[model samples]
Target: MEDRLNRIESKIALSEDLLEELNLMVFRQQQQIDRLQQQIVDLHRQLASGSPGERRDLREEIPPHY
Candidate 1:
């Protein structure tokens, strides 16, 4: 019947809208994930460069009178 066809069309439209919304949400989430990943990489680089190049050993120190 025509009524059944109309109902089916409406359902299809609604489904398409929902699918588009979900896709947009996924895109936004991926952007946020990329930004966070970049931040982590930047922080790691900062930590690596800020540390001392080498550590000194106490055993290598000579006694005060030696």
Candidate 2:
């Protein structure tokens, strides 16, 4: 009777802790997703700003060697 109640209470506490941890994990993942989405938007804008007919020179991308 009392022992059963204690076990149930213990289980409930563990479940609550697990739920909180899961919620925190979800929140962190959402933040990362939002940042990634913003980065993608920025990249798209950068690409769109370049002239459509222009070709980037490969040599221009090379780092200068001393």
What TM-scores do the predictions have?
Answer: 0.73, 0.78
Tens-digit lDDT string for candidate 2 (16-56): 99999999999999999999999999888878998445797
Superposed model 2: Cα runs more than 4 Å off:
51-54, 58-66
- Tens-digit per-residue lDDT, 1-66, candidate 1: 999999999999999999999999999999999999999998898778976346779899999999
Instruction: Give the clashing residue pairs of candidate 2, or none.
Output: none
lDDT of 1: 0.93
Candidate 1's TM-score reads 0.73
The numbered model that scores best in lDDT is: 1
- Distance from true position, residue 44, model 2, in Å? 0.4
- Show model 1 residue runs off by greater than 4 Å: 51-66
Q: Candidate 2: lDDT over CA atoms?
A: 0.92
